[model samples]
Target: MKKSVFILLLFVAGSLMAQETRLLRQPTLSGNKVAFTYGADVWVTNLENNITTRLTSTGAVESNPVFSPDGKTIAFTSNRSGTNAVYTVPVEGGTPTRLTWYPAGATVCGWTPDGEQVLFASPRETAPSGFKRLWTVSKNGGPEILLTKQWGNNGSFSPDGKKIAIDRVSRWDVEWRAYRGGQNTPLVILNLADMSEELIPNEKTTDINPVWLGEKVYFLTDRDWTMNIWSYNTATKELKQETKYKGADVKWLAGNKNQLVFEREGFLLTLDIASGKTTQLSISITGDFPWAEVQWTDVSQRASSVSLSATGKRAIMEARGEIFTVPVENGNTRNLTNTSGVADRSPIWSPKGDKVAWFSDAGGKSYSLMIGAQDGLTPPKSISIGE
Candidate 1:
């Protein structure tokens, strides 16, 4: 009996350890290593040895790590100096050297093909805040050069350095799957010598991350439902799907030479350019996830979309993507949507003061109208809203 109980406990512990962990974003690849952002901090991992290293350990968020062409340094964005600014540090890990000092922030997009300068996107001259333009600054820190006069962001220079494949508009919600909103637009490859343009034939789909690799432009598109790797041959004007991912979308992709690496569903995958073969790298990142620590958090400032109950004695609120109900004078505070990977939004209290309604993706591909009791006792009713 004692042995059976011990084995049962061991099985439970193994199950808990096997739970999936996510939110790994903005991955960039070099010749032998891959760098990505996890828990708002930059991390690097070797593709061959599976050795992982932490690049930054600051209170402020640091993200969007891009490797220099030589693979000696990494450029990333950090709010360590107050506002978001471009910064670079040694790939082995050390103090970062600030590159841009303008009042408006810049994000590292990619390095110049010649490796002379670091390319970035900023909105310093743009009147509006959302619109961004591509710019480049010397790695040694100097004046910024305007790469594009029009509104554009997330661009990569061609191999010849005379042209670029860029995305004109940025999406508001990148994780909202199959989004065909007004912000969606096709990518454009602009020739700098003649100021000429060529469209990539996007009818009404979201296309982004226009990477110019040799004579082909590799990008991410949700035209076939789930986001997958796609390539457009400049010479033949042919578009083809590179990967057929059915479950999770490919999060971030970066490539150099004949190899490409990307992150998908918290796992790292590498694609061989010549052979068209993809291999999932077995990388084990072991470090202190400081942000994942359990502690009391003040959700007051994070609250949004609050609606009062019928009698005004209670209120339903959405805070940090979780739906909750709090009392004014009596009753206990309850978290309605406790599932971590799911998204519950626009929570509103019912007029009758008995139920709450909200729109939730629930980590699925579609959104649903979720209705449940205000007190958290009953299972929520989910009605499909749309795809």
Candidate 2:
């Protein structure tokens, strides 16, 4: 009976680990499928069948996946070749084809309406200021063509492919909540034919991730001190807020004429353009993470605090949130506090060399003073440090 219960517990634990996952980001939608970046790889899920497939598994930071017009191909940015560049892979999973070779790196934004070229942002031509400009390269492979001289970090072409709704500046600190400073800029509707520009209405608020769908230009903004989805109707000359999320800001907005996909609070969600309804996707990812495997790490060079014994025979040090001691000339290095889950810091040897003192959060609360023998053979006495 005991052996059967142990085996049943293992099965229960494995089942819980295979449930829905969070932290999904950079979602792009087309038809009944959506693609996003998770665990540094691209994954696609079909809304109808509820099936998810991993597209790229190179273990190289791949992100910003944009689906093509027909939903057959996906363009994304990857640093697999030592630089962030554009790459394309099929929706069903296959070999990724390199698209750009710029040394300055390129980030995939979106594709043109015709689906013949892939659009990206790069700082290749801008040397002194290093501001990015819009560029596009043929999906079949060729030299990238400069789309415009104006700065553009993220954008999407209109349905006609004649105009683009673009964000002119990319913020240095994107996650600084409720920030209103000089870095904030409005989105621009640039006419590719005459190079004329029309700025979206703004009052020094952050507006980014422009996606053009039909007569409206949809984007994410922090105008209300919380990032939410907003739209600018060109025909009616009106601006309206679509989503009223209060906690976390919406990120990585991308879409087509049918619907829009974005990330909010680590979940992938979609908004119907016609109906204005939103739905969160439930996706579960199961795979082997080689980097997360348990292994020994050397933290000697990461020592943050150190103190020498009074006799100069040993030294106590704090490194990687743990306490350690090393002999000056004779003995091997010893880890005095091996509590990996707790943070032990500011270690110092006692003046008489019989004890070690440090601050630790071993009680799972606030830090407190910990005093123990130098050999770590006895239990450390923890003294409370009140709030």
Candidate 3:
């Protein structure tokens, strides 16, 4: 079985909408051997030795890290050049090199199995459509190959590298329908050789993130009004709804090979693709809100958005708002941070799945970054940087 990955193309349009379940291909499959950081920074771990190595030491933000086939090098996005561009470096240590200098930005990097080229999605500076563009660059940084005319992001190559799946925003000029329920986006796939694109947009539905296993293209869809697992077969062009969890955020874990792992109501669940069945992955008392963006229509009809953790294992998200964990696998979740309802969000996991980092207002400032271990059995430790 081959593994493929796709990411959500995040952008703001006519109305600040909230609805996304996306993930750039980070090298987490190497067990603790890989993990990407915010601002395009990449780190690799040796699971056998529990050795964590910092691959890049740049002040520029780096993110969305992917490992080479041999696990020797990593490709990621960096702003070292004053713009978000794709850069590659050795897993051990070295100076990073730029792959895309298009001036607009090279956001996401999907590495080929052979580690020769990277497929990515970026906003085009001169694109006529005013949306993002999807392109592929050589590992050594060469000419980019354009794939679509519409705004494309979250592009991933299959384990075999024969197929590429991505999330495409058909247009950037968004016409707000109403920030009540949710907006619509399309989950699309492309055949790398012929450059053919396929749209599997469900009725009045928006889906971001596309991953592949064997023949099924796994993606997150809000078709049932609640985001859950959905699969499409490129050969049959048919769609199947895998899970139905209402009022929850559902997304795919990077390395979950034959099973579909997603979060539902703060509990992580796994679905079997072949049989179209789902099972519980984990559960906790951590009461948290789903991430991406959502059309929050409160009684007053006010509109605001939220950020979700990529791991989907948190209950209370967003510091300054509320902070909670997804109930540890065993035992109750300890209050790591007793912040008084601060707005904290975007909790990401380290390769070892030990430490978690997120942006929050628990510090009383605008938003201070916080890092704590998953063993939230103790008071949540704040790993905010010292000014």
Candidate 4:
């Protein structure tokens, strides 16, 4: 039978070449472990031996790790003291404990079902910093209580924390895909013993991470256009669709009583609120990506656009999408649109010094111009712009 179909295509290509794919970012789940955030640090995973440890390797970028309802503590978000505050460590890794300094920067958003309070989300007394509120600070820090005066961006804490499901208004673009606009609200649930409010069912589209647990609340929805996993039922008010994921989009959901972790496409998934099954955790991260190693990167403070050389003896720059040229005092430093999968950009430098235009999309559908020829050696003429 064709040698058993070529040995079942080499056992599905050697079981997908012994698996390894990682991008991981903002995951949370607790109860067998799963904190996440790659490259910018913070990692942890066990889910029965998927083993991944590495928690917080400083240099200012840590992000939303959250977990600390007794999961031994995590609470993240750190620009390492240049803002974006709120820190805390020890989920088996030590020394972090900073906790909110406030000069406008807070986001952690989790902790406080009696873990002694951490939760965040800020706008520091909104006046035009663009609405946000729901604070709390005291894991031994000083004062910062504001819990909810409306205006939100992720909240969850109900299992007798006296209610709070929140998500009042947030979405200046949570990734945009299939966004039905108007900031897509619908997910309130408040009620701190009578501030009463129970929305959930907005029809606008991008509902977001709400969480709640026990009689159900969970969230993240694009109402069927990608970001999946949903549920509502606070006693049969029915609204289900627990993950019908059609490939990538349910990101950073987080959960506990029997799993629910999320983040998709860069892998790190979980879900199993009792076998509603959705597993993807095989994790394999092996150290040192040091901003993706290979060193040597000054990028003149992220250039953006420079040009010169109409006899100025070389310049052209353009940073963060590559396209270099440099040499105003000697040589060597070319790069010119190293096309990291085409995005080239507005480079411009040719007025009789031998080409260097830009604008490419490299035909991954439209936008061309391109022109090249200052030593990336011939072969670059393109043209074709629009559509």
Candidate 5:
């Protein structure tokens, strides 16, 4: 086991230095509890004492896990039924309930802020126009509601749930093909009450992932045709570009309207709307790709990188010969361990942002869970999987 762990950690360190980091999606943090994908499984960790629990099984490729508003349940899509369909499970692990019984496969984007429904983009009917509707489903796991009659995806709900902001695929000059990235999609905001749709700045630019931050709705746009990140204000009706750097895949972590935790250029960064300043999140060379993304095979050589817990305070990560940390805001980072043979992988922050749980091969053949402190840096206690 010790020998295997050494090899695993060594591999992750090598990968970081080996490739030009392929950016994936960021985990959505709800308070101190966040969901993470590991080898087709979604696991939740409590940061208080490093208690890790598996929230998903039948894992046949589960990703994009989002927590309900009450944090008691998780909403995500799984290919367990041979196609992508929405599934819900208890935050801790239990039987999953299928939300979308559509005969067609589907993928979800965002959830309503109230946790009452989920918003997604998928083919609504038989293939004729390839019409993908902006759809939402009740958390009670019933039939879904087709909110918009257009073919689009990447949905976001305003904080109050009165409005839905999404990317619109307006012009389709070609035949409909599902699951493939379509064309002519731009940033679109839909008023649910009135069904009035409004288009934002650029039509050709890919304006996706619209997040409602209080008075303004912020989204990632390549308005300059650079695939860079941008933001929009709903209250002032002012449009703004937040970054000069080419950051395409970005996520809003947790903060007020002005402050945001996001990822850009393969680095997790924080931006302040009031100050117009950005700060690099204190993380190691963690890759953005999560376990649920690709097949369990292609990324196997890929090791776990860095992850933020619900609190977003301290970061727990595995790399090379060290599991390290610095103060998230003020303190400097300190290396917790430097064992060469123990290849630690996948650090998840607990809901309280107090403890961290990770998988390491220090024992042998199979990877197991290791729980430790958010800052104290003691050796991790192995979590029993009952295998």
Candidate 6:
């Protein structure tokens, strides 16, 4: 009986440790595989078996992973070299090859319909530096060719590669939900042959992340006051709403020929083109998070609200939500409020130089005045300041 109970407890502990990770972003879909950005690295998961593998583990941020046309390679942007640039790695994982060398950073959008080149946006040659234009570089590495003279930040190619659907303006803050300002622009379908432009119907709402699927251009719009999937049929000139997500704005919409994948509230969801059905993809990530570990940090450079003692023997300051004092000519720096989880601010030295005072939220209900010994030898006395 004792052995059985012990085994049951072990099983329960294992189950609790297997909870799925949320907050995944920038999801791209192609066939049965999906790639996204998590923990500042790029990760790929196979939908068939639900096996997730970390592709890039660099210290720099890697984001916006777009699959190749054949789904065997992923193109993403990384700031590993001190500036954002384009890179491509095999879908199964391998050494990434840098493709862009311009000073201005490039953001990976998607692949050309033919899979011969990787599409990206950059303001390299633009005059004002605020306008970004779409450019493409060959997968084998060569000069990047400008797709169009018109300004474009993110775009997708048509099935035949003759035309492209692009968002002309990039918002300064994409997370500003329901933003209906002048920056809000309609998706532009630009004809490569004549440079003619066709604007999708709009009423000053934010429309972005255009993905071309079949004869329709699918995008995310805030026309209904929440960003959701909407589509426009190029053949019939008809518009339709694809998904009615009211909770969190759908972001980073990407697609293949038959399916679409996006992020909503930090979870990845997919929509089938034929059935119009949306399903959340279950993904679990297990690894050691070294950044989340507890470690001592030097707060000297972050010190604020400094005050000198009455006789100038010591100085008190607040840093990293803690109260600290440093000797003027000798002794070590003393941390008065060592509480790491509580916020302590506005520290000052007492007029008599016998004590230190600060306002802290240690009570968890309101800010309170905390008085402690000058040498941190005694616990602090808290007097609540009601909200």
Give lDDT tens digits, candidate 3, residues 1-387. Answer: 233221211121122213221232233344335454422346554645645466776667777676666667777778888988888887778888888877787776466666787778877764454567678788877789886665676766667887677776643322222212333556667777777778775675657667676777878776676666778877798888777666545633443356544444433344566677766422111112233233332111211233323454433233223334443232343334544336556665666566666677665656667777766555555655553
lDDT per residue for candidate 6 within 301-372, as digits (tens), equals 778898889988778888878777877766677778777568899988778999888999885778999888
**Whole-model Cα lDDT per candidate?**
0.83, 0.87, 0.58, 0.79, 0.62, 0.87
Q: How does residue 246 of candidate 6 score in lDDT?
A: 82
Tell me how far the alpha carbon of residue 332 in candidate 1 is from the true structure, in angstroms, after superposition: 14
- Residue 189 lDDT in model 3? 71
Cα error, candidate 3, residue 361 (Å): 13
Instruction: Please give the clash total of every predicted structure, in order.
Output: 0, 0, 26, 0, 11, 0
- Candidates 1 and 5 compared: the better one by TM-score is 1
lDDT (Cα, 0-100) at 114 in candidate 2: 96
Give one digit per residue, the lDDT tens place, for model 5 in 1-387: 111121222223323433232242354545555455545667665534535466665539887777776778878889898888998888868898888877787776767777788776777683765666778888886777887775566677788888877766533432221213446465777888888877776665555666677777777655564444566777767887777754243433333335665655544455667888877533222334443233212222443466655765544555553565544454555555554457666676778877777776775556677778877557768876643
**Candidate 1, residues 60-128: lDDT per residue as tens digits?**
899989999889999999999998899999999999999999998898899998888999998888764
Clash pairs, model 1 backbone: none
Candidate number with greatest TM-score? 2
Model 5 residue 134 distance off true place after TM-score fit, in angstroms: 1.9
Candidate 6's C-alpha runs over 4 A off are: 1-17, 298-387
Error of 4 at 328 (Å): 31
Cα-based RMSD of candidate 2: 8.4
Worst 10 contiguous positions by lDDT, candidate 5: 1-10
Descending-TM-score candidate ranking: 2, 6, 1, 5, 3, 4
Tens digits of per-residue lDDT, candidate 2, 1-387, equal 111100000000122246668888999998999999988999999989888899988869999999999999999999999999999999989999999997999999999999999999998979777998999999998999999999989888999999999898888999988878988887899999999999999989999999999999999998998999999998898999999989779977988777989999889998987898999889888776666555667665678787789988777888777888877766767778778668899998787899999999887769999999999989899898793
Better of 3 and 4 by lDDT: 4
The candidate with the higher lDDT, 5 or 6, is: 6
What TM-score would each prediction reach against the true structure? 0.73, 0.77, 0.55, 0.31, 0.58, 0.76
TM-score: the better of candidates 5 and 6: 6
